[model samples]
Target: MSSARRHILIALDMHSATDAGLSTLVSIARRLDATLSGLYIEDSQLMSAAGLPFSTEINYLSAEERILDPEELLRINRLASAQARHLLEELSARDKLECTFAVESGKVAIQSLSIQGCDVFLPGRSRKSLTRKQVTLQLRQLVLIYENSGIFERMLEVARLLAANGMVSDITIVSETPLPAEITGKLSIEDVRWHFQAVSSTRPEQLRALRLNSASLVLMPKDLLTNLTERQWFELLEQLPFPLLLMD
Candidate 1:
């Protein structure tokens, strides 16, 4: 686990909603007194596809088809990166929190995971979500995937802060085994209820199946996700309706 003064990294893209990730990030940063960092990603694969002579672009809102131009895509990425940096600068100035920003060209998820020196990673909503029906994320109940007492301790700290900030009343622990006494003793918060969701293991399929509607935020430790590949992590984040925070 990282120290309270560790860095919190946020992964963003052109379609990202800064408010969703930054609000949570700022809250946690203030609570932990941590520094903030932003990573703006440009999809290299999309840029390559746009370079194809026969490649075409279709408007999601309108049914119009147009030629995909790599140069235009690159320009758009630059604009998005500029906008992201501006937002981070504003956030840093407003919150008086240390902030850093970087732009990388590659697979968004892979690039984010490859970054070093970050203690915690909060990935913004997937760009694919733009085409789907939007669902409101209310922080009423939080789902935490428990691995062990050590990791759970760290997860609980953030969960508690989020619960307090979001006025969350219940927190559910999804675990393969029952919590030991050492772990259960920590769940005695006043006015906050705790529940458990049993799973066979922390496999990708089981974890995906446990996405209950009541959960507004899901917290999972990076240690428990040893079975997931980089691509799987990307897909998982893309499919989740609510945000998932991964702690190292």
Candidate 2:
């Protein structure tokens, strides 16, 4: 058995929802004997805006007059918090893994801050709407997404394939700096030292060097690609040399 504790961070939201994301996290955590952390960012702006009451009770309303009210915001926050807790509990129960929850108020990017010592990030993939600018930013390590319902099985298959081909021995999970709170809270370099041979610096150049030297395949959740324009998508494709396994 591996001695290192694998760490994973999950982004909790309403659309893609938390249940599926937590399910994936638990599965991965169990396989790696890792702990999971759940983060729910309460975008002050979004919450504030969504809290507004409708201008009129009728269905048709003027766009300019529509505004969120405090009651609405409270309701939304309650629902989001409930979902986040439910997921955390479920994952904790299944794997006997430690879990933590955070509800912060900030921009989406700020809320998505990295957890220190995390090996991977599991985020939900949704087709509803995309944040164009957010998708362009470079993120560290593997970004697991729910492509279809069967993504977990696919990942297992991929891991098995790599193991069979002797490629698994060379693979390692890496992350950028400012790791998530949950990771730093529960683990240390000493804990992971045996399982991961090296820790790459957070710099882009260092990351590139590590990827070239250590990894044969880089995995990311398909949702990371959702909001990109064709040009952006092609650019990302060109930049990556390894075959990306897009989890469904």
What are the lDDT figures for the candidates, one per model?
0.69, 0.45
> Which residue pairs does candidate 1 place in steric collision?
none
User: TM-scores of the models, in the given order?
Assistant: 0.80, 0.46
Q: Give the TM-score of candidate 1.
A: 0.80
What lDDT is reached at residue 114 by model 1? 65
Clashes of 2: 17
Residue 67 miss distance in model 2 (angstroms): 4.5
Residues 67-143 of candidate 2: C-alpha lDDT, one tens digit per residue: 55666656777797787788677758866888887776764333443344443343434222323222212111232
- Candidate 2 has a TM-score of 0.46
Model 2 regions lying over 4 Å from their true place: 1-3, 48-67, 127-248
Q: Per model, how many backbone clashes are there?
A: 0, 17
Question: RMSD per prediction, one decimal?
Answer: 4.2, 14.1
Q: Best candidate, lDDT-wise?
A: 1
